[model samples]
Target: MLVNTFLPLPEFITGNILWLAKKGFAITLFLIGTDLSLKVIKTVGIKSVLFGVILWAFISILSFIVITVF
Candidate 1:
């Protein structure tokens, strides 16, 4: 942001930078997916999974309520 303020980029360069940022984001997600281990989840046990599901559901419901009410 500071660099952009000092030396403004042209429209085409800014567009290319956005494209590169998106590609980098996709590559990062793919790398993270490749490193993920399903076996670790299995070892963590069903109770932990159930607790996570409950927490997720609670958060989802709370956010929905907040959005609708606000």
Candidate 2:
């Protein structure tokens, strides 16, 4: 946003870059998903997964509270 205020990018260039970035991100996620397997999940164990879920929930709720309070 700041950069655009000083020297705005051409629409065509920004569009192309955004298109490329989206494609790259999709491909990266695809590769990562392909790498994940049941074996890996089994190794991580249910306990770890539950812990992660709880931690994520805690952080998300805390963030929401902070955002609303401020």
- Give per-model TM-scores: 0.45, 0.47
After superposition, which runs of candidate 1 have C-alpha atoms over 4 Å from their true positions?
A: 1-38
Every model: Cα RMSD to truth: 8.7, 9.5
The regions of model 2 sitting more than 4 angstroms off are 1-36
Query: What is the TM-score (0 to 1) of candidate 2?
Result: 0.47
Per-residue lDDT for 13-69 in model 2, tens only?
A: 778878998999986796486685567769989787679769979999999999999
Worst ten in a row by lDDT for model 2: 30-39
lDDT of 1 by residue, 18-47 (tens): 899999998679547666346766798878
Pick the TM-score winner. 2
